[model samples]
Target: MQIRDLPYADPGRPDVRSGPRFLYWLGRNQLGGQLRSLFWGVVHSGSVALFPLAVGMGVAAVVDRSGARLAAAGGLLLLLGALTALGDTMLHRTAVTNWITAAARVQQLLARKTAELGSALTRRVAAGEVVAVSTGDVEKIGWFVEALSRFVAAAFTTLVVCVALLVYQPALGAVVAAGVPLMALAVLPLLPPATKRADEQREKAGRATELASDTVAGLRVLRGIGGEELFLSRYRSASQEVRRAAVRSARMWALIAAVQVVLPGLLMIAVVWYGALLARDGRIGVGELVTVYGVVTFLLFPLRQFEEIAMAYSFSRPSAQRAAKVLALRRTAVPADDVEAVAGDLKGDLYDPATGLLARSGELTAVVVGDPDAAGRLADRLGGHAAEGAGDSPSVLLGGVALDEVPLDVARTAVLVQDKDPVLLSGTLTELLDVPSSGAVTADAALTAARCDDVLASLAQASPDGSGDPLRTRITERGRSLSGGQRQRLTLARSLVTDPEVLVLDEPTSAVDSHTEARVADGVRALRAGRTTVVFSSSPLLLDRADRVVFLREGTVAAVGAHEDLVRSNPVYRAVVTRQTDEEPDKELVESGKSEPIGESA
Candidate 1:
């Protein structure tokens, strides 16, 4: 693939079995580019290897005082120079292409995986770890793949140079050949220690990154609770640990580098010492001895490629493993094999078999549960979240077809589940509301439906959009700049704008005041008059407005009726919705001039 073609049209499924396997997959994906790099690498190194041969011939011609031999030697030197320049230039270009394409391929895989898993991706892996992998880890993996071809070329050139020397002058050639392998093998024992150090460094760095990400995400909360210093201190400690691990890793690598330097120098000395003896014994000419010395010195350059390749592999292995781990995560299964296609145009009831909760089409249903975790799980099941390790997953059906069986894109288009703690992405207000256009809801209408007029007024204190509208105001990441209630309202507005056939909101107004919560309940009901809406909440304000309220006990639906009837007849429902107990009977309701009618407004 061409470098310009980047981000493959079909990045294709990756082989994420292991670190090495993933790297092999990357190489396989861009086979043509890799081969080009390999060819250029061989040509360049081979040209470099011919340098000493030209030098040897030139010295012999000078010694023999032969004009023709000298001219031929000069011509050979010029040819070697041209080849080296051309090959080296092209090799650098191809190697860079390999690096970019490999990195692009990995980035595409990560993006695809993120889209496939959605929010569940972070639940399975740390958000910071995901960030680290997509950024620095990808570059390291690319570096290893790019360096592999150069390493192969270097090995080939070394072998060819050694054999050429042996054929030209046997005595010195034997000594030079033996020294090269010894120098290359000297550092094998150090590799294990270096690899361990690198792994430690990566682990510490990932921890530091995680700590930093969490701290930043919750900075506003930390400030509110006066715990900012505690988090800062923890981050400082994590940073120091990363520093220590990095230094340890660097020290091991430095030792390896020193070995590379020292051993190559010693090998050069051996070749010169042995070559002098061969020249003295009259077994080889002085010019040939000079050529052998020059050849051995030049060998040191290619030998360094081995050191570089080892270092690259050491750094990249852990990164590849982390990338593979993320790629292996699968979302809830889509049971396509056991089911046939269902008519997408037919709107039907949403049924959760595990909880026996059925929300009919065109109804506003509120689920009230004493346990928030159970409520959350029901909401997740309704949204088709795949729970782990189940041979037959509990399915949520829409239009008689399991939601899990429906294509992910179609399922998502039909049902949108807003989490209890919804995130408001950072952008101008207009950009934040700019979801894909569907149905008939506009941003203004959605904002009104979610009761965000006050939010707009608050934002209008700053400069408004060109139309003098606060809808264009900038929102910080996760809407951290806004109050909890305002962020909740804004998130609700965004969800409304999508206007999906079914909107499943999990405690969407938990942070808002009772009055604002009542308003949101009214707005949602008015806007979603004929669409199925499921709100998981036990708040009296929301429950009172829902057409039907399902009371959940333990894990299953225990009662289903109008909010007033259930509160008056069911003790468990009254205790949950009114926050009543034997000792206290919801003082907020009692003091608000509302007496013991269970569903009375507080």
Candidate 2:
């Protein structure tokens, strides 16, 4: 395919069995581009190799004192120069295109895998490692893929030149041919050490990258806890380790480079010295000796390609492996043959047998768990995601069908889970709210329900152009420019716009003020009326609005009743919702409507 037709309709399933296999798969997919690059490379190398011959012929013609022959030699030289320029230009163009397209294909595959895995990807793989693979590793892989064709062309031209020299001038050609191979093979002993050093450097760099990502993601928390200095020192040490490893790797590659240069220089000196002796002894003509010298010198260029290819392969091997590892990740291990499709119109209660938590159909259920970790796990299980390291597949069922057994697309469409810390991707306000929906709610309605009018107003006021339209305002990456409450509301609105059959939100209003949280609770209740909505929270404002509240102690359900009933009857439930110690007497916090605000304790 042409470069313009890139971003393949499908990058096709990659062979992720191994790193080498993945690299091979990438090459096979781009065979057409490789062939085109190879053709141009051959043209360029062939034209360059013929230059020395043209010069030798010109010298011979000048010596013969024949004007006609000199004129013919000059014309040949001019033609060769033009062909060299044309071939070299096309060769470079095609090679760069091959590199870009290969990198693009790899990036596309990674993106697809990420979308398939969703949040589970970060759990299986480090966020920093993913970032490194997508950025630096992709470029390294592309370098190796594009280098292969050029190396082949260079090797082919070198072989043909050696054979031609051997036939035309046996005495000098023998020395040239024999020394050429020695020059190419001289650096073989150093490749292993160089590759090893490179791998070490890559490993260190990945760790450093991961550390930096973690530091930045939790920078605010670190600042609040006065732990920023501790993390910074830790990251500094990691950065130094990476620097040292890089130096070690560079030294090894430099040694290999020195060998490549020294061997080629020695071969050129031998050819020039021996050819001069032959010419002096009447064994070869001056014209022939010049040709031998020029040919040996020109051969050095192609010989260097060997060293380049070796270096490229050493660096790219590890990169391809990392990419393969990420691509091999699976969200769930359900076999393709075992998948069963769910009816499009199916709707029922969402149940998780692992914890005996159930949300009846067409009801608002609030789940209160004493342990935050257990609450998070329940949220995941509610959406059919098994807890990490769990032995069996998630037993969460909807409409009498196991979620793991049903197709992933169907499972996701049936249940939407918004975690405690939902991320807001950077984009215009309009683009952020545009997502797959059931045609039941409009963007404006969702925004209003989530109480995001203030968020929009602030964004518009901050706009450089002073545009009052909030939809035209832009958000920074991860919504770092916005406050926690603003980001949470925007995320909530995006989730609301989807209008999924079952919506599970974990502490959706944890970042907002009491007034905003109360309004959000009401907005959610009104918007999600008659729909299966499961909220995992202990906020009195939110719990009071729930039609039914299920309380959990040590994972299993301990009590189920209305918010007021549980507060007065269940002491454990009261302690969790009121944020009070069990030994502390409950003063009926929910009843008095004097619940502590989020991030505060009694």
Candidate 3:
């Protein structure tokens, strides 16, 4: 088939597959090209078998004292030899191209599936498995695709040589025809076990790859908690387990190799023994026997490809399964709706069923969630980044329209949630703030609102991207080179630039000091005038900025009122603000409520 005809097959096409099926489909994908290559390969194989005869013929003609005629025959033999070489080159080139194309097609399918899955992919498949599929399995898929034509060509080549010998001299021909079957059949019995072990080895390798990826991604956190050595030990154990599985697999393949060697040796013995009888009986010419021997010798190499194809299948099958699993993943969190408009303006309030909290529009609301886990889930749900059914997940609504029902891009454009720990990409200060749907804001207004004028000054001092200009300088990966507060302020500035209809701030001021956080709260409230803003924080400074503050008990709103009103009426709200506990006297807790937990003490 033409490259254009390599239709997009489902990435999940392969099952707990054997390698042959994968190649079968791969060959099916490019049948036209492969069929042509197979025809050419056969022609080349036939030429290869005949070229040996030209040498023997020239030698015999010289021995028979027909030098002039033999010399002319010699020129003809040389020309045939050159043509044979050219055919072999074309056959090999086409076969390799077929392999690469097949691999590329599978890779394209895998990429499409990955895009469809997004972040949900890692949850379903190990990172290492994904890596292994891309690295090793892809090549194997190609091998199977490219091997089909060669296998076909090789089979016919064996047959063609067998017929040529029979026509040239029956005695020698019979020996080759009979012996070649023995060589091929010998490996058949050993195949089942060989393939099984190869598959086992491949699986163990994939697991090992997954383990390594997990260990690396969390290495920093493990070190921070003094668990680095423990994780290292676990990874070492995993590595050893993979090693053992690999060794067992290697043993099985080695046994197959032994069969491969022994079977061909016996075939050679049978052929030589029969040929000796033919030569002594004068039933076959010495040159005819020599050519037959040469053909069989060449045939052995292609037969070995059968072993290679089996091995390639063993490696590729597991890889295809891993890729298939990734392709099967759907970003279920995003809604399927085709939104007509993102939002001219965010209407009504944001309500989360999981937490029974309502964030009213045109108001600064503080949600003091008692359950941190519930709060995080509610945050994800509120942003329409996770699925919500009933109370399975939290829900955020705009004008009573469930956030989950809105199109992803529409939801994103409407509600911008700044998570507690936000990611800062590497780029110029201007580029970093250039997240989707955000553009040149009155940078001064956003900066003044996020209280990031200091960060801008720092960038101006020494730009990481070499511009020494805050708008042009690039940050390092994860903003690792920046301080915690600097990164938080930068992310806030980016969010402010988007100027979404509703802004969700989850502990946006956690990294900064109280005075700076207080300033930021005022700036945000002022900048978000006439817009919806929800801040999740217990800081009295941030709470004071809210037009309404809701105290959460268990997972429901215990009280909803102004910050000062809630403090007077709700004991939980008072205790949280004053950092007081039940262990403290109720009178003291109720009085100032400043007895509540101190900064970072919660």
Give the winner by lDDT: 2
lDDT of 1 by residue, 1-602 (tens): 77777668998888889998998888887788778888888888888787777888889999999889989989998998898899889889988888888898889999988877665577678888998999999999999988988888899889988998889988878888888998899999999999999998888888889999999999999999999999999999999998999899999999999999999888888888877887888888878987888888888888899999999998888899999999987654445653234435426788877777778799999988787866766676677554232234467777776776555566677888888987888888999899864758989899998899888987877645456568667888988888999999999999999988888999999999989899999999999999999999989899999988887766767778888898766666788888877334455555566544333221
* TM agreement with the true structure for every prediction: 0.82, 0.84, 0.77
Q: Summing lDDT over every window of 10 consecutive residues in candidate 3, give the lowest-scoring window.
A: 593-602
Q: What lDDT would each prediction earn against the true structure?
A: 0.83, 0.85, 0.72
- lDDT head-to-head 2 vs 3, winner: 2
Candidate 2 to truth, TM? 0.84
What's the C-alpha lDDT at position 500 in model 3? 80
lDDT of 1 at 300: 82
Candidate 2 regions with alpha-carbon error over 4 angstroms: 332-340, 343-346, 353-356, 370-381, 384-395, 400-408, 421-434, 440-494, 511-530, 545-547, 552-571, 582-602
In candidate 3, what are the lDDT values of residues 52-134, reduced to their tens digit?
A: 67766766677678888688768877877786788788788788878777777778777876654334345456788888878
- Candidate 3 stretches with Cα past 4 Å from truth are 1-47, 59-63, 68-116, 146-149, 163-175, 178-182, 332-411, 414-417, 438-442, 461-482, 501-504, 529-538, 547-602
Error of 1 at 190 (Å): 2.6
